[model samples]
Target: MPIHSFLNYLALEKKYSQHTITAYLKDLNSFQEFCNNEFDKQRIIEANYAQIRSWIVALVNANISNRTINRKISSLKSFYKFLQKTKEIDSNPLAKHKALKVPKQVQVPFSEKEIRNAINLLDEEVDFESLRNRLIIELFYTTGMRRSELINLKLTNLDFANETVKVLGKRNKERYIPLLKPVQNSLKKYIEVRNEMNTNETYLFLTKKGKKIYNTLVYRVINNYFSSVSSKVKKSPHILRHSFATHLLNEGADLNSVKELLGHSSLASTQVYTHSSMGKLKEIYNQAHPRSKKN
Candidate 1:
């Protein structure tokens, strides 16, 4: 299929992450299957709205999630657009279809106490890997960087004299977060241990063999940490970041400040933590009001 060439274009020209490319492929392949099973068509290039709409009906009948189905539809739109650009087909068939919609749930953020407990669980007596994982957790919460930004951080990014670490955020933008004393000390210790292993001059964090840390390893460390800390809350590295912004908001930090700290592209993205703060206010209001008591 010419879809393969378009996918290669996405990887090379578009510079999308492998994860995104894989997702696009999965959606395209699913559509290909739908065509074969429903319309008896083998080529994605030959598909039209009649076949694609049938795929949507199949998705609904199969009870797939609104989010998943929406993403698949969006993928089809992109695929058709790619085909159109290459003259593989004339018009984008999936463009006019309305995507499935889902409401965005407001996720609960962890409390400051939970953050403290999780960090303390990192035993200093353990080996370098243990300490490195602890420091990764610490820096992530402290800096509120996205996982990709954190993983891609280089040794040269740290500026000790100025007490700030410059992070290259999404779209090649850079931002600086302050280097707190505790974080500075933890970073120093990690760097000391990191240097003792096989030396790599570029990447900041690494395995014992001096390989760069990958997303799976980072996610595993975060998952294990979350499991040990509190089962009451949903946990991901992003949850820690949400906790960071919420804690700051609760402590009187302004929305714009939190927005910049979080590297959110828009104020709306950062405004969700304001909702968290409002929930706290509602709890206090309900507790104090005499008529608010329930039997």
Candidate 2:
């Protein structure tokens, strides 16, 4: 099937991450099923905009969020574009379609004080798990790495001599992030305890059984710790990432530099942090400007 071929293209030619490829495949399969059931169409390439619109209407009636529906639409659009590119189809059906308007969601970063307090709450005992968790938090806050990047981190990636850690980001792009003195200290301590396990795991972070850490465990670690420190509705790895970018921008870091640190492919993705920084700017202006505050 062309869908299978397209998925192969995404996996091999595009070099998309497995997680991304899975999502695309899921979206494509969902659309294909809809076309088969609703319009009795056997082939997705034979679908037109009206059939696509009917499926979208059904999605809306099913109460799926517009943001999610838009993502599904994007998946279909990519598929159709691919079909056109391969000459399987004469034209793209979604060429004139506009993305659904998603409401702006401003994610609040944990304050520096909140982060400090959270770190302070870590157990004073320096066990492997404690050290590993501490180092994980520190790495997220200091380096702004995605959870996947952190998960795939290897012992060889940490360059103590150069004070940097190389990260394998999305699409297998590699970037080096500088380590702060505190992060370096934590890493050293964690390694000291980790070595006592005597296992030859190449991955930096490991489970109690000396296995590589997975996504759920990482999310739980972040959520469990941050739940005690901040009252934010969401407590996840990405929040620490948001805190990293927001805090850096608040401290006067340039946008391009922050973009590079976060491993964002484009400046536009990094621009979202500026909204959080704008709040800080307003606060500074109100406090420092003459006659800014009411008597």
Query: What's the C-alpha lDDT at position 65 in model 2?
Result: 96
lDDT of 1 by residue, 192-257 (tens): 888788675588888877888988788888888778777755678788788788878876788899
Name model 2 segments beyond 4 Å from true. Answer: 1-99, 286-295
Query: Which one wins on TM-score?
Result: 1
Q: Which segments of candidate 1 are over 4 A away from where they belong?
A: 1-47, 61-63, 71-92, 95-98, 232-234, 283-295
lDDT of each: 0.84, 0.92
**For model 2, where is the 10-residue window of minimal lDDT?**
117-126
**Number of residue pairs clashing in candidate 1, backbone atoms closer than 3 angstroms, sequence gap of 3 or more or interchain:** 0
Query: Could you tell me the C-alpha RMSD of candidate 1 in Å?
Result: 4.7
Give the per-residue lDDT of model 2 (tens digit) for 1-295.
8988889888887657889889999999998899889877667888888988998999999999999999999988999888988999999999999987889887989999988877887758587888999889999999999999999999999999999999999999999999999899999999988888968899999998999999999999899888898999989999999999999999889999999999999999999999989977898889999898678
